[model samples]
Target: MKLMVHYTLKNKGLLFFNFICVFGFIIIELGLPTLLSQMIDVGVVNNDDAYIKKIGLTMLAVVIVGVLMNISLRYFMTRITTNVAASIRQDLFEKIQDYSHNEYEQLGVSSLITRVTNDAYQVMLFMQNFLRTGFMTPMMFIASLVMVLRTSGSLASYVLMVLPFLLIGVVAIAGFSNPLSRKQQGNLDRINNILRENLSGLRVIRAFVNEDFEEERFDKVNKAYEKSSKNLFRLMSSAQPGFFFLFNIVMAYIIWQGSIQIDQGTLEVGNLIAFIEYIFHALFSFMMFSTIFMMYPRAAVSANRIKEAMDTEPIIKSKENGVTQTETSGYLAFDEVTFAYPGHAESPVIRDADFSAKPGQTVAFIGSTGSGKSTLIQLIPRLYDVSEGEILVDGVDVRDYDIDALRAKIGYIPQSAVLFSGTIKENLRYGKDDATDEELEEALDIAQASDFVAELPDGLDTYISEGGANFSGGQKQRLAIARAVVRRPSIYIFDDSFSALDFATDAKVRERINEETTDATVLIVAQRVSTIMDADEIIVLNEGNIVGKGTHEELLETSSVYYDIASSQLTKEELGK
Candidate 1:
């Protein structure tokens, strides 16, 4: 994969040094067997004790050098592999962060997490093994073959006959295992998806009394993953035994032939012993090579997955030389804006929606479910770009502005409040990194969260669990609102943010927000009629089109859709007042 090349090249100098150490180790390994032949033939045949001691000390010195070189090689390999893995992970995370909402939906969060973690680790394992055993195997095999030939040509021929079978078996195993390895990685993704879903939806599963059903669902994927893993390991396991068997048959032939040569006084016992040692070295190297190749298929699959994530180009990207507006007065406008998610171009979720809001004005969108009210407001910040027409903020096209600059001017609170795992102060500080204690208190006061926060042990210092699991739903929503308020942006968006609060707290929070943000544009998407009845202008939508656009009283008098929504939540006397 290209990602592998990109990271491996980062430590090329260290990697080169590591390979040099491998070469040195191979030299020592090949030299030891040759010295053994000399020790037996020249020293023992002539009964020369001095020659034997000299050869023995030389072999010990070579062994010590080889051990030291192996240590250095391992140290460099570990550093290279670990750093490359970290680099790949960082790059993958940055690419994922740049993905637009559409791309996020295309690649699910669970799959991306697995790719960043498990797949990256797989590549690291391959690189480390390749450096340690992979390069040494081929060099050792060639050197051992030459030594065996110098010792006995007949035995070399027997070893040569076994080479073709070993090569063919290795190739066939790799070919058959590659696709299965890919499938195994895919199965792992499925298992992770199920695991994530079950954990996130544990409450819902218990509420619906579907625990047994969820267990059954989990079992199916788990069993499939196990089966795939078992099959892949089985295929890889066969290579080692097959290589050993073929080399063993060649060893039998060598011994039988060497016995006849010795009986005919044509081969010395020392040469025959050395030739057997050389055969074992060659076979061991070939076996190690086979094992390395077995791991390659799985790593290749993982590398491809990592490449896919790194290569995905986000559809929403800033243009080169994108304009940056120096000043924002919170003037947001939608000019005949229409939008559809990536695949449903035939039918827009919001169609030809025209609206405008100025500084200090509160514009509200009131609609039934699936009426595109939330989708319309999201376009102002370019969460998902409009499919047709344009959205302008501060009289400049949103597309023309750098995305970061444009988003800096807006504070968006989604319908579902999400908080990271941190202390309350840390979560609040996410909006404005330099915010002071006074600012936090004021924001909490405006969001009607101050009283509750003061009552908690440690107050703002209290640590929140993941996703704010430690807090109630209403408390989480209040903190979310306070977080946005701390930003003090030009525009404040409350997307049904008050739904979790009671009517009284909702009324007080809205009043406080109005008092504080009188100079900033406020846009709200709410379902309850009471929440938006006081909006300066309310746009009522049905399906994908605007059904009414006017003040609450004007809509009640002129539009039945608005009237029905108001009457459903309030009595006639209340609506009249």
Candidate 2:
């Protein structure tokens, strides 16, 4: 609930005006009943037609004023609530941009999407109803009760007796609703997560022939969501009827007793009419308030989920006033770096890894599947910081540099090729925003992708589908390589990026890159030994430890781990060459 208030503060002026509208409307509404009593008791009793006309005209003016105030209140509420929802979503999005991979993993992507979209909508819905009824009802109830007590104390006593019961019902319903709301939201997260997985992995599911299994899995969560929703609604569905029933019974008693007082000449007919009006206002307010109370629990649950994401500070916080530039480029060193993921501190994925690369050098790492090859290169970009030691870039600790400035110096191509839904030009501009068309063509030539891209009718203007689904795996990889080459960065990192291409294309791309990167450092991570056989230096990793570091010929005779890997992938003729 406080989450809403925090954003609501941005439009305090509108809120004040909205409050004025509600107050003015309540005054007009309460005043009309009193004016009606005067018209009936004085004008009708004395047969004064002029007096009746005057009061009737006055009542009409007040009604018109009340309608105007209501219209104003509704306008202010609509603007403020919409603005607040937008602000909340925008801030939440900015917060998400700052998150490191650790936060992304901690808060699942599907759940985060739900929070931004569905949860934000829930807050907006609650605000819409709340602004309309929340302020009006309580003040209306108290003011009308005060008037009722003044008009006739005996009738006011009956209304007071039911106050405790109504209050008790509100508290009890809210208490029961909160837990159900929490359960329903949790189930919704599960359904979204399952849906995301099913869509993203549709090919794998079809390949394995598991459609029925997936359907059953989806149905399990759907039914659970249905059950929670049904229970919550059943409780809500029964409440209005019960309240209305109690309302009818109480109204009957007040009217019957008032008629008796009138017959005895103890109560004036006009006074009795005004008393009934006040009682109606008070009870009607309680009815409106009851609806708000019913919605509060769900809104409160949604607000808490949004607040949790807002409160989460990213684990990797760079130095506030960090260095923005360096004295040199294409120089990197990892000094006795040992790192585990955030939780598994005792079991490191990279152990005591000391390495350095200077300009004009090509360093390649080869290892088995879980040998931490890709993880090691990721350290250079500070994707995940080293747990135990520091990594230096251009003779400065990476942590001491502005994070964005540090990333700007390197062009990294991850193992998975990613392309957004846009023309090739837009995707290439992501690497270097102001890159010229000639520069783009040159980068594509270096990556060996210009041949295919030139075949397209639109060439650079050809639109890519989401995740480059329209492109072949090799084509996507080459485009990703071209994207990195467009940057002409100080250092280039290709983490198993060439695995998708054939040997000839891979070799051609590497040869062109070597010609292009004469002044920049290159780091390659690969599973294929042929990929790194011509490197300036090759490092072999076994488990988390670095077992070998040397040129191809040097490692073949000296390091068993390197020899075993090279011998399995290279033919005797190629090895000899």
Candidate 3:
């Protein structure tokens, strides 16, 4: 919330101007009822036509000013709110970009998405209401109370007696609503997570005819959310009407007491009328206060949710002593490296993993599904630091090297082929923003994605749906490969990026990448034995331990784990090929 305030102040003058306008409008609102009371009592009841006409005209003028001030205030407040929201969104997005893999994973995607969309929206509503009702309600309440006290102290005492009830009601509603609002946001996150998963895997769900099952799961989440929502509303519903009733009871007492004073000649009819109007104003202000109380709990919950994400410290941090390295020889080495995830104390994901890939050499990692092949490659990019031991890139501890500089030398393609919604050319250009059309085409050609791209009506201009849903799995993989290739990094990491391609296409793309990138170091993490069989060296991992390290022939002779993997896909005849 402080972060949002800092951004809001960047346009300090505009916001301050909005404040002046809002306060001015509040004064006008307070003046309107008071003026009407005067017009009715001092002018209408006095039989003074001249006095009535003068005050009546004055009231009309005040109304016009109030209307104009209201318009200006609304426009200015919107300007302030819009600018503030945009700035906060930008800063939040920029912070997200700095987050490491561990930090991102810990926060979880659904919660972050909710913060960006729903939570930010809540903050915006708070700001808008804060400027409008937040300021006006209190000023009006206090000012109206003062006016009533000056008019008649005895009746004002009745108004004062209602204060405790209003306060008590606000406190109770706030207490009950706070926990439910938090639960509501949490449930929203859960629903978002489920929806995200189902949408991403919609094809698989339909293929397996599991629509009913998924629908039932979603129905459970939806019902839980609905129940919580109803409970919160049921609790909040009491404050509004209950406060109205309490305030009106006080108003009736004031009216009855003032009527007696008027009949007894202690109070004039004009004063009695004015006193009643002031009571109503005072009560209305209390009602606004009650409304504010109702909104506070939900806004506070939303603020806390946003704060949680903003407070998360990135598990991976760059060292102060780190220096940028240019023109790296791309020498990679893992010396006695051991790493484990946050939980699972049984064994490290990659333990004492010792291996190296020299400049211009292709090193491949192959193993069973849970084998630490992908984990080992991730260490090279410093996605998660080694729990114990060192990883060296270009003969320097990877941590000692500047993160951006080290990453500049490495092109990483994850197991998932992620592409944003954009033109084919824009996605490719993400690797190297300054990449020319010729460079893009050359890289796409190397990845075997250019042919299909050219067939599309817009070619490189063709628009991709979110996550490249417009493309086939093979095409998405090829485009991802092209994105990595466009970077022209000295180290290329393919973390099973070729799995979506057919065997022949995968082989062709790998050959092209290898031939074109002679000076680059290639590290492949693949499930297929055939993918890495021709590598200069292969590391076989099983259950977080390096079970084997050798060439294909050497592995077949030395490692049973390697033999099992090789035997799974290869017939005796295919092995010969």
Candidate 4:
């Protein structure tokens, strides 16, 4: 809620002008009733036609001014609310981008998406309604009450008697609905999560013929959302009617008391009529205020969700005076590194891992699944900082280097190839923003993607579907490799990236990369024995520990773990050759 207030204050000038308009509007609205009373008592009762005309014209002018003020208020309110929402959305995105992998895992992707989109929008809607009438309601109520007291304190007392009951009802409804609103928001997150999961896994669902099952799963969440929504609306719906009922009783009482006063010659007919109008305005403003209370619970929940993301501190942070190095020999080293995922510190993922790779060298890591091969390489780029010891690039600790500067020196290709919906050229340009046609084609040629790309009707201009869904598995892998190659970074990491390609294509792509990247360090993580057979150095890992590190031939002779894996994949004669 405080965060929302901060955003509202961003356009103080507009808010100030809007407030002025609201003030003017309240004055005209509340003043008109008093003028009507004067017109009846002084003009109609006294039989002065001139007085009636003069008061009628004055009321018209005030009405015109009130209309203009309302228009001005709406214009400024819309501008402020829309801009504040945009700012909140932008800041939320930037904060998410800064979050480390830990934060991402803690706040799941589905929840983040909901906060950035739906939650931010809820705050915007509240802001729009709040500025439009939330502020003016209280002012109108108070001003109208004062005017009624001036006309007849006895009639105003009836409004005062009913006011506390109305306030108590609003408070009671808000208390009941607040928890329901939070539950509704949670239900919405669940619905979004299931929808995202279903859409992304459509292929797998069809492959397994689980469409009916998924539909059932969706129904479970959807129905929960429906139930939660109905409960919330039921509570919100009760407020308006309950308030109106009480106010109507108060209205009846006012008319009863004012009629007696008129008969006693203490209250004029015109004055009684004016008193009723002021009472309606006061009660109606309270009704509008109840709407604000109803909306507050949901907006408060949304604001808290957004604030949780903003408040999370990223675990990995560089030094304030961190070094920034653009030129390096591409020398990387791991010094007795050990790491465990946060909250599982007792069971370390990688234990006492040590390795190094210099420029012009190829280093390969081979291990069974869950042997921490991918986790080890991720540390080199500081994706997850090492729990113990340090990783260094050239001679500086990775933690001491500016994050962006360190990352820019390496081109990483993950196991899964992901591409946005855009032209092939656009995807390639993601690696090197200003890459030219010649450079793109060269990288494509090196990764062996040029042949298939050129075969397409539009070559580089061909559009890629989301996640490269239009391309074959091997084609996506090759294109992903080409994207990294386009960057020409000092270090290239292929994290099981060759799994999709056939033996021949894999061999050709590796050969071309070796030739092109003679001065850059190459690190490959592969399950295939053939892939790393010719590497300058190979590290064999088992259950988070590296048992052997050497050339392929050296490891075959000295390392039993390496021998068992090599024997499982290659024949004796094939291994010797």
lDDT of each: 0.90, 0.92, 0.84, 0.92
- TM-scores, one per candidate: 0.97, 0.96, 0.94, 0.97
Q: Taking the tens digit of each residue's C-alpha lDDT, what string does model 3 give over 1-577?
A: 5655765678788778777876787677667666777777777877778887888888799889988888887887788778776766676677777788777788888888888788778777777877777767787778878888788887788778778878887888888899999998889988999999999899999999999999999999989999999999899887778887887788788788988988887877767776777677778877876777678788778777777777777777777758686455778889999999866546688888998887778999988988888888898888888889999888888888888888888999987999999899999999999999999999999999888998999999999999888789899999999999999998999999999999999999989988987888999999988889889999999988999999998988899999888988899875554
What total of clashing residue pairs does each candidate reach? 0, 0, 0, 0
Model 1 deviation from native, Cα RMSD in Å: 1.4
**Judged by lDDT against the true structure, how good is candidate 2?**
0.92
Model 3 RMSD vs true structure: 2.3
Tell me the deviation in Å of residue 504 in model 2: 2.4
Q: State the TM-score for model 2.
A: 0.96
* Backbone clashes (count) for model 3: 0
What is candidate 2's lDDT per residue for 1-577, written digit by digit as tens?
Answer: 7889888878999999999999999999899989999999999999999999999999999999999999999999999899888988999999999888899899888889998988898898898888888999999999999999899998889999998998888788888999999999999999999999999899999999999999999999999999999989988887788788888888999999999999998889999989989999899899889989998999999999999999999988778999888889999998999989999998999999998998899999998889999999898888988998889999999989889888898999988999999999999988999999999999999999999999999999999998899999999999999999999899999999999999999999999999999999999999988889889999899898899999999998889998888778889886775
lDDT for residue 451 in candidate 2, whole number 0-100: 91
- lDDT against true structure, model 1: 0.90
Give the alpha carbon lDDT tens digit for every residue of 94-131 in model 1.
99988999887888888899999999999999989988
TM-score of predicted structure 3:
0.94
